[model samples]
Target chain A: MARLKIESLRKSFAATTAVDDFSLDVGDGELVCLLGPSGSGKSTILRMIGGFEQPTSGMIRIDGQDVTRLSPERRPTGMVFQSHALWSHMNVFNNIAFGLKLRSLSRGEIQRKVDQALELVGLAGYGHRQTFQLSGGQQQRVALARSLVLEPKILLLDEPFASLDQHLRERLREEVRDIQQRLGITTLFVTHGQDEALAMADRIVVLRNGQCEQVDAPDVLYRNPQTEFVAGFIGQMNFLSANVEGGRFRHPDFTLDVEVQDGPAVLALRPEALRLEPSDSPDAAGVTRATDFGSHIMVDVELRDGARLKVMTAPDARWQKGQTVRLAASAFALYRQNRLLARGGLPVETVEGRSRHALA
Target chain B: MIRSYSSTSGRFDWMGLAFAILLVIVIAVPLLVVFTWAFTEVWRYPSVIPQKFGLRFWDQTLSRADVWEALFISLRLSATVTALSALICLPAAYAFARMKFPGRDLFFLSFLASHAFPKFGLLVAIAAIFLQLNLIATFWGVVLIQLVGTLMLMIWIPVAAFQAVDRRMEEAARDVGAGPLRVFWSITLPQAGPTIFAAVLLTFVSTFYETEGAWLIGAPQIRTMPVLMINFINNQVVVQYGAVLSVILWVPSFIALIFARRVIGTGSFAKGFGA
Candidate 1:
């Protein structure tokens, strides 16, 4: 059982700190993805775990052993790089056999293990093919075989799918996930692409500016981002700046009783959660000319006071440019904080649980 | 068919052909003349063709101690110098090419600075230093001085060669559980083999034919080939000059030249020197 616990890890490159007070735990058989943009320290944390880099301050314990100061070869871990660093001079078989050779395994044993690895990556009978002669996808398999042949306790992957084409990326992602599950290895994967992280990882650790913005299972992180950064980074978030006072939330020209702050607050509304209707009571308004973009229709509605509210309608709807309409977002209960980004006991009481009577 | 014919149609220029022929002749004629004269019995001046061709130069030159000793010393000294220089510079070259450390560029620039002085200007001082060290007539002195002087060229060539091996390859090897030494041996050194071979060959050839370094600081007991040739020519012995050069020199140089094409390359040299 390779249970990894990283405690307050920090890494600095001279004056530039790449990872700051980062901490996480990966239970046995968990596949965790460190998701972030470039320079977000996602890759750096993976490197530190892989033993390729030393954290400025942290404790890395694997199955209760501190392996932070160990070299990569000494640590019970295997890593695949972004470029699929296969040995060009060696054939597929020999490349994968390198680790076995280092371990002083018998030639027969090495051959058996190598063949098993090759077939595992679906490159059976390709043992003699040189790495350069293989296609990009095949070369990626060779790289995978090279690492899987060792079957280390923890597997670290650093953007391995970034170079693969879209079709191959999809296929290989499934293959990798299947293989990881089959081996039951604890894994740490790093990627800047959210879709890849969402598709492959059991849990996603969203990072920004050398700090952990949030760490939760994919659905939780996506649905309940505790901070604005997490909400914005995960996918599309339609932002509306408003104020909360007198136990009520105030949108421009509208107000409703809600349990929230008494000062400035930003509401991140997903476009799909917004609703539209004809303004029979004259409170709702939407647009006409800015309609019908792709499968959805984007309408801009102007209030009598000239404040504009935008809403997306289905493509089948017949909303045109000159029409004025009613617009209202879903209830306040529809949105939630992204807890991965929550800083403290920054007290987040649920909307229904609190005594605010209506919505915020 | 129309597209194929159009693609096949081309232009020709006679002036370009004539100029190319002229350039080839201008380059090839001198080398041809040298080889032809070395093979013929035409030791006298002003002869378009030899009146006779014989093994007279080879047979006579084989008996001369000075010629044999000089050629042997030149070959041995060059081999020793080249080997020593490569051994000393290999690690330094790898560092300069791939590693990042404090003041690397400044330290590398210091190695190149020794070549700033003209060889002619340093003849007297080199001679003095050799005398002080009692290396003025020692074979080790020739090898030592030649090694230091040739190191810049040798190190720079391999440095550029190693730099061309792509740092990503090294990083890959390291990621795959290879240590620093293993990375160099398996990745960097293999990639740089051809270029390093060429560098060593060039250094050996240059040191073998070096006239100034041998004359200024070499021991009379360990005479280099060029010094031997010059002394033979200065002795007013036409037959001896022919014998010493043709038999004692041309064969080995000709053999080396035949294999020189292996070391020299065209576009692929970009990977050697690193664009």
Candidate 2:
């Protein structure tokens, strides 16, 4: 295992930049996921780290050794592509043994290593089978084995589970994580999947438009997103436009006294943070719709200003169309110019004061 | 959509059966007549079949020194043309398929220019040049002219085959510690081998039957079988000599077709054309 340091990595095509000044330091044996939507340069960064693509500028070091200009064969890195990329001309044994044979290993040792790799992938007896004869999941296992058999210091996975069905993707990801932990291989996974990143990565790097948005643990990213984009991208968030005037954030349906410069702002509220209660006042928000999702009910509420928002609450038969209700956010983030200004609604005084101010 | 008539319930497919019969008769009848003519000592128009069938012309045609020389020349010219064209075109095809260089597409399209015009006119122009260089009636002169015809098949089919190879597989090989050359030999070439072999077989067969270039460039001094067969057909009073030569010319093509059947059965031959 080895630590990977990417410093100021930049890559550009002829006209546009793919990755812009991207930098990250992955600890030894840590699986850091580069998470983003399409065209966010996640794959470009992974390719640079794997030596598939050269960076337009910057340095990549493995274990403090500069390897930015090394070829893929010379680097201590192995990659698993999304297509499984198995050599169709070779059988499973030969595919896994290809790199070993290239290293001029003895025939008996190559055979032993290949057998051991197949067993590790739970396909102990499939050495002689052609890659085309295997199922999609089995083929992916063979791909994983082919990379892992090389015993590289760094493993690069470029959305290896993207093509798999949901059930199989979950199972294979778990298996891969288990193997990675057992071997303690430093892995950098690139994906457009949020749940996969959240479930598999020790630290997830959320990217947007070829720049780093936020890099943190999954729970921290969910609970304390530092930007409006991160708040919206990571989980379900209800963005309510408000005005921050004289240190008091003002919305049509609510207001909160916050420590911030007065300007236009947004109240980014998580669905679970919002609660609803039946109210007799006609000016209170009206429920437009409610969906029963087995464990919780999602109530769509329209405030007095006709802005709609979703509130997640315990299953309640009373949350139906045209039901008047008062809304309350247990915790919410206040943003100004797309940047987080304050996270309020924590203390009892603040939560109660916001409601009192709204009612006034 | 119009549904085709189904033949699944043991019903007779008369249209299909008629088409099959017509295809066989159209293709096989001339071959049968040629074979008959090759063995016939005498045959008159009034007789439905030959009055007597024997190998008289086969022995006669096989006995001539010129005929043996023509046969040997034909084989040598075809082998040389096919090998030389393969050496020149395969790498060009690979570069056209994989690289991103200036004028790559234009250069690739120019290979078609050889076959785009009337072939005889092009051969005449080349033969004029060959005469000035004292290359006329030389074996290499004939090989050069025949090489023109091979450019299309040798480059086009193999380009499609090489383009069909998955780049990700090569990248995966590189990731697994193989260098660029090793990846190409182990991953790229093997995947594209069958279709390339099919292209070679087609090139060989076409070169073997190439007549116009051989007749135009290698007249008088170097005579291929087709050139000799054309001579016999025009001058010889005995019909069997030409017929026997026709059957002899068909031999290599028939063997090539058998190999082509297997190659095409694997589906790579047609796949080389984006099938």
Candidate 3:
């Protein structure tokens, strides 16, 4: 295992900047995920780290040794491409043994190492099968085995599960995490899927438009996003435009006490943070729709001002169209002009499971 | 019940059957004529079949020293040209498929332009150059001329073939610690093997039947089968000998066609094209 340090890396192509002033330090034996949507420079960063693409500026050091100018073959990194990229011309054994042969290892040694790698990926005795003959999931395992057989200092995965079906992707997600932890390899996984990043990484680095937005533990990033983009991107959030006046947040439909300066702001509330209580007050919201998914129900409410909000509640909470409901947020993050201002739990006043708000 | 089912499904369409028979006759008649001429001792006008049939012409043609020498020259020249064309085109094709250097499109378009030019006209100009260099009537001269005519096929097909291979496959090879040369040998070349084989076969057959280039450059001294066949046909007295030689020339092409069919049937060729 090795610690990878990237300092102020940037890549530009002609007129477009793909990755700009990006930097991160991945600890030894830690799997850090670079998470972003398409065109967000996550793949470019991964490619730079793998030595497949040269950075326009900055340095990449592994274990304190500069490897920025090294070619991919010389870099101590192994990458599993999004397509798996198994050699169609070679059978599974030869595909995994290619790197070992490049090192000029003996026949016996290559065979043993390949067998061990195959067993690690749970594909023992599949060595003789042709790569094209394998199923999509099995082809993915062969790709992983091919990279793992090299025993590089770091393993890079570039959206490896993007091509698989949802069911197989979920299963492979757990398998990949298990193998990474068991081997304790320092890994950098690039993916656009939030769930994959959250479930797989020790820490997630969220990127936007070639810049780092936030980097933190998955749960920490989800609960305490540092920017408006992160707050909205990490989960389902209902954004409400409000203003701070007299130490309280004043929205068109409701007003609540907050510790902030008097200025324009936006409040981001997660669906689980909001509670919906049936009420008959004139300020109450109307339930437009509700969907139950066994464990919880997602309720959509439209206030008197015609602004819609999503709230998650217990599955037993029955709601119907045209029903009047009062909205209460347990926690929220307030931002001013895309910068975080304040975030915490709200002290809501309630009476018999209903929010106590005066009707307008 | 089985008879009733056959009667419904196997109802014959007379028009389709007649078209199939006509197509077979159109293809087979010329082949039958060639075979007959190879064995005929006497064939005159308005005779559907030869009055007398024998292998005298075939035996005589096979026994002649000039015939065998011309056959050897044709095979040797074609093999050399195919090898040289492949050597020149493989790397060019790879660069066209993978890299984005300036003037790449212009350079590829030039190759297509050369391919589109009339071969006989180009050969006349090339023959002039060969004469000044004293390359006329030499074996290497014929091979060089054939390479110029056939280079486009060798390059164009393989460019499509190489482009069809996913770039990720090569990247994965590099990621596993294979260098550029190793990656090519283990990954790129093998994936393009079938297409490259087809190209080689195509160049070989075209060079083998190349009458114009060989006639223009190596006719009097370095005699290929096509040149000798042309000479025999120009003289009506030895037309039967030309027929025998033509049958012999068709053998290798027939075998190559069969081999190409098997290679194409393997379905490895054209794996990536238009995918």
Candidate 4:
């Protein structure tokens, strides 16, 4: 397995940059997902890596060698497309053995490898069936087997489970992750599906408008997003405008203390992070519980300046929507995640190159 | 929803039915007469049906050296012509149908525009060129002329057919690691099956019955079915209405048309071909 490094990779169409000047390293045997919404440059970056599209400007390195101009056949990377793309004319056995045959492997060896790949994908007995005769999931397995048979240094998947239903998607995702981990193959999975990325990636690179907004483990990304974009994108986030006053911040109806000064100039909290309590309780503290939204309770209360605010609460707790309550995120944590997740919003820490600590 | 009639149209007339039936009889009368005359026996002036049914004419044509030679030449010529023309047309038709070259629409329109004129109109000019090239009276010469006149017809019909196929097939093929030629071979050519088949059949029929090109550039010894049929009518004193020439010339084509018909009716032939 090989590590992949991209430096200032950029791809642009006529009036838009599908991928901005972005860079990230995928270590050996590490699975990194380029996760974003549609048009966020996730697939474009994947295509650039797979040699389908030429990057406008960038250096792509595999292990340590630059592969900016190598053809897909010459590349040591295997890619699986969202459409499955199994050859309809070939039978199950031939489809898996295609790459090995191309490399002029001996017939017996090719057959062995094909059979092994098929068995790995759990389609061992479908050797003679035509690709078109297989079901959607079966065809997907065939494609996976085909790529896996090559045993490249790295594997790239572009929304591999998008076409499947929810149940099938879940199963296939687990299968792909399991196969990838078992082989210890470095993989780059591109998808607009955040759930897919978060569920499987060793580190999730959440992209926005062609630039990387944040990259970290799933829990870190969800608990503390780096940028305002990441904060809004990862999951449900409720943003409230507030003005900082020395060590404290004042909202319309709530006054909270910030340990630091100005950053993104906006305060944001996830629905699940904010706890709720009864507004009229004599000992009301932290966020008060409010509206019952079935899955989770939504709390409505007043800010310091009397403006209304809503936060999420646990589903088991009883809450009402219009009641007033206090809100505190001390337990929610400020910089518990990466520095990007911190409110100071400065370059508090850098993962690549040398670390530059903020002199708070 | 407005008030619309379910059982009846706004205007329905018994007179329309009578008129339509009358139209069918009028149109079918001439074809029925040709069939009647084709089956009839020898007659002094006129005869509605054959005096007696016999295989004399059939045997006569079957034994004739010239008729057999014509049959051999026609079958060989048509087979080669259809195959060669399809090879040239299929790729061009596919390109026209699926891609956007600089002058694609213009070139396709020009090819279709040639269909407006009868094949005979270009005979004089083509003959002059053929004579200058000293190609007249050669089998290859006649075939070449037929290829030119029928190429556009072969290409256009199939181009339209390819255009009607699902556009995703090509994109999918390419994404699956197939290059341009591979995609065409596996996905494109097969998916355009029905239209291509119809084109091949139409091209074969047209070239088989071709008189102008074969007559202009072909040798007397290399006459095709229609060319020989014309010669018989023009040169012979006693009109040869025997079944010999007719049965020998038309039967083979009839059999061929049946094979072509299967391809035209349904596109099941495309199954193994498309990846």
Best-performing candidate as measured by DockQ: 2
lDDT agreement with native, every candidate: 0.75, 0.89, 0.88, 0.72
- Residues A1-360, candidate 4: write the lDDT tens digits: 789999999999989999999999999899999999898999999888887789999999998999998866567787888888775656889767756755788999998898899999999889999988988888889888888888888888889889989999989999999999999999999988878988899999998899998889989998767777777778777666655557654443334456766543466655555544344544343333366779876776554434444566677866553444545442222432234333533222111222223233
lDDT of 1 at B106: 94
For all predictions, the C-alpha RMSD in Å is 6.1, 3.6, 3.9, 8.3
Off by over 4 Å in 2: A278-293, A297-308, A315-326, A346-360, B1-29, B39-43, B46-54, B264-266
Assess each model's interface with DockQ, reporting 2 decimals per model.
Answer: 0.32, 0.79, 0.78, 0.16
- C-alpha lDDT (0 to 100) for residue B128 of candidate 3: 96
Q: Runs in model 4 with CA error above 4 Å?
A: A241-265, A277-312, A317-360, B1-51, B86-113, B116-138, B153-202, B215-222, B229-275
Alpha-carbon interface RMSD for all candidates, in angstroms: 2.3, 0.7, 0.7, 4.2
lDDT of each residue in B1-275, candidate 2, tens digit only: 22235558666667777777787789889999998999899999999899999998999999999999998998898889989999999999989999999998799889989988999999999999999999899999998999999999999999998998998998888888889989889999898888888999999888888889989999989999989999999999999999999999999999998977876556787777772
Regions of candidate 3 where Cα sits further than 4 Å from its true position: A242-248, A259-264, A279-284, A347-360, B1-26, B39-54, B237-239, B264-275
Candidate 1 vs. true structure, TM-score: 0.83
Let me know the DockQ for model 4. Answer: 0.16
Question: Which is the leading candidate under TM-score?
Answer: 2
Candidate 4 lDDT (Cα, 0 to 1): 0.72
Docking class for model 4 is incorrect
Instruction: Evaluate candidate 2 by giving its C-alpha RMSD to the native, one decimal.
Output: 3.6
Q: What does candidate 4's lDDT look like per residue over B1-275, in tens digits?
A: 12323347766565666776777689767555544444544645585565655555555546768776876787778878888998887878878877879998788777666566776777767778988898888888888888887877777677777776655445444443556676667667766666677677777877888887888788665788777777776776534443345544566568767887665655533321231
Under CAPRI classification, how is model 1 graded? acceptable
Model 2 steric clash pairs: none
In model 3, the fraction of reference contacts reproduced equals: 0.93
Task: Give lDDT tens digits, candidate 3, residues B165-233.
Answer: 888999989888888888888899988888878878988999999898899999799999989988887
